[model samples]
Target: MSSATNSQLAIRTRSWMFTPATRPDRFANAAKSQVDVLIVDLEDAVQPDEKAAARGNVRTLLDAADNTALPPLAIRINSLLTRFGLDDLIMLLDAKHAPQFVLLPKIESPEQVLQIDTLLTAAGKTTWLVPMIESARGLSVVEPIAQSCSRVAALMFGAADYASDVKAQPEALALQLARCGVAAACAQAGVLAIDAPCFALHDAERLHADLTFAAANGFEAKAAIHPSHIESINTTFTPSAERVTWAKRVVEAAEKGAGTVDGRMVDEAIAREARRVLAAA
Candidate 1:
């Protein structure tokens, strides 16, 4: 891909924040927040009785479009098996504006991704997709799901629901294998891997540690339930000034034919990493 395209995708999802479609006022508030992506959730955030109203509200917000003042918009539609899923797609089909992305929850197979892709194609929409891997079946076939459709920009690891599905604790440590699996799949597919939220909203220390671990394990971005967490998540995923400096030095040394940098052996792989860091920075 071209440098411009790579840069666009890199900066597209550093801090993804979700706002309920039922609360249209919050959409404007979230748009102005520090989040890089704003997702208007029509799924779990809305109650059963409010599903229809939430869809209408989201459509109204889309009709009065303003991409300049808003972050990249996405909508988390309900699962295909759910009663509200078809309705969500129908609404999007007739929308005056299209979201930059659409997040599909509880994805289990490539066929599911293909189905959405087909529908969007038929509707003449070019929205990208972010598939949520939140179940054992979904985790097991994440690689296929990531590679299923060309429009998949990222694969999101949904921890809480995955934990419930597997009857495990919602802690990161407990879900380490699943998280790493997702990261590896996205990497192999050359797409982004988004980490799940740290549900302990009050525990800043835990959140920091979780985000750090996620970045170390290969997640490109993280989702946040509250705006308070956006700053930290964005900061954590971004290369720090010190790290950027070191990467530049390493690249310089490698170009000079030096095999060592700060006492560590430098090779083609390490040099490539340095270049990636600078590009991302």
Candidate 2:
């Protein structure tokens, strides 16, 4: 997918699925899975020996017009601190195929975003960015990082790494503040905040609880570890039928000026929320 296509998808994305760049065959499957965003990981998911191979696979996958029919696609590069990162940038920047988004892992400051934005500009690419906040330092400066560059379309939370950094168990409640912090920063920057994936893919109850908690805490989307988790995440993040109905009612009443719905007042703010619910639905 091109960056233009990615820009549209970023506005209302809910389910973000990560597929390893090492497995190009899975790319088509991930695209067909109806995920809002499909990310090809070249970072933690790819080993040192496989980095070069994964980069080639990602380049070939992107170059194919047949692959462009997929959903909004992204490439998660290795950290700038590593040797592979510069090579990843050089190859991707010169590629004929354009990826809509570039996922930057372990982002710690706004300057890092600015530097990347500059390079992409120099290369004459319109690729957007998704900064991964994986540590305490990243969480602290997340707001600035989100606002650092216009190229940034979303902010992703890395729960496992963050949990380790804070010396806490990677539990829903354990990372509550961190999750909330990332969401609040995203809100401040007017960008999407995506929740981290639940490591235990088999725990359906925990997954549901995690989604519910993320939604309540203001995250607009969640990352999925496995393909099976996409549908549940999408359903959980989407506004319900009842919510859409209420939203319509609120909007209709607001159209008639000040009014009440079920003994409660319906004002501009309520109407706005209703509109948002309808949009999400």
Candidate 3:
């Protein structure tokens, strides 16, 4: 599709673009981009010495803008177990405008999500949680993590951290189990499953394969470390026109008590998938 077609697509969870929290020069530009969600990354993108200033930048940006003008905003805070995470939490709570999503990194259990939810509640912010599952421990309990709280919006897989934790390479084959686990858990919770951001910044072929892997395994969205990745992410996650037509046929078949659509069986699971495709479209 052309750039105009991509821009015409409404705001959905198909692509999330990450901007370094420290890059004030690029913040507004990223917000105006075609990315579905603009995340001011406070974790991996900022240095320890600059984390404080990054937090301030986020606050000032939020203070200066009308929320409606921007796409959905998210902040990937450090783990709540760390001092940096606690400080990030405090900054978000005290901000004049709350982000739509708060991405918690290195989340291994449901309790961490609950604690953050409680704090946001006390502070009167309605921000939803996006748990980043990037560890063996986190993947083990991903089901509970995805279903942790009502505010839990999505589960984002962090392959880099998982690779480090498992002493493996950060490739699709190596992280396939972790990815599948996250996707299944998100499905169980009836929330969006976000695949990890493609680190190969300019390798279009690698990015396409990565996105295909995520989609085939049930992930609904993928994160982008750079703006260039947003187009592929959006295109891959979106249901193609042909698939949408097939889904409509499947739905009609199920409603008419037909056993098949174009010779394919329309069982409960297939019918459910068709409905989901329509929803995505």
Candidate 4:
């Protein structure tokens, strides 16, 4: 799809569920889930010996998926530096149907995004990109990376990998800086910023808490490792009635050329933000 077309169909992508690309049987079930995005993961999720089989399985699944109305489909390829990444790209080029996006894992610089963008262009594919920031280096260069690719639709935090990289607690304040950096970078580039998946599947309460924190910190969506977490992620990202009302009021004031709202001066910038909130809802 063209970049404009991709943007128009972009769901806020509240919850993205990762399904192992090696398992074709699970594709149908994943497509029927409530998750905003279904990510066919070829990295970490698949064994090294199964790479070839996984690629073939993903291709078959995508072929069959053409007739189904699915949540936005994405595939998380292994890092471009890996042998699996090259194989995955070659296989994707031969597929009858391409995924809506390719999630690049362990992205650490703008050069990587540009390199992939060049590769995609040369292959005559319009599949958009979503970079997964997993290291401190990735977070540091996120802004340039986001701006480096016109086809980039979002920046996703790879929290599990990031925590491991930095040797810090996942839910602690130490990681807040990196998270905020990613969110700010995405916002500056006018692309969606998705929070990392909460790994604690059994602890729904903690997941909810983490989702809340992510939302407050400017994440528009999150990744989910399981179907059970999709509902809560969706709920957390959705705008509340009060928030919607305020956004509406802000828009109304802007329509009337009013420059103030509730005793505070409002401008085109604030009005634009309000409209974004309403549109997201």
Encode model 2's per-residue lDDT on 185-279: one tens digit a residue. 88787778899998878989988888899999888889987988899988987888888888899999999998898887998888977876776
Query: RMSDs, each prediction?
Result: 2.4, 2.7, 4.9, 2.1
What lDDT does candidate 2 reach at residue 159? 92
For candidate 4, write residues 182-231 as lDDT tens digits.
88988888888888888898997899788888999888889989888888
Off by over 4 Å in 4: 1-7, 262-264
The per-model lDDT (C-alpha) reads: 0.86, 0.85, 0.85, 0.83
TM-score against truth, every candidate: 0.92, 0.92, 0.93, 0.93
Which pairs in model 1 have colliding backbones? none
lDDT of residue 84 for candidate 1: 99
**Residue-by-residue lDDT tens digits, candidate 1, 1-281:** 11122355645578888899999888778865779999899998999999999999988877875656878788999998887998998888889988988999999999999998899989899888899999999998999999997888889999989999998976646599899999999988877889998888899999988998899998988999999899999888789898899899999989998778888888888998887678667
Residue pairs in collision within model 4 = none
Write down the worst ten-residue block by lDDT for model 1.
Answer: 1-10
Comparing 1 and 4 on TM-score, the stronger one: 4
Residue 247 of model 3, lDDT score? 97
Error of 2 at 136 (Å): 0.5
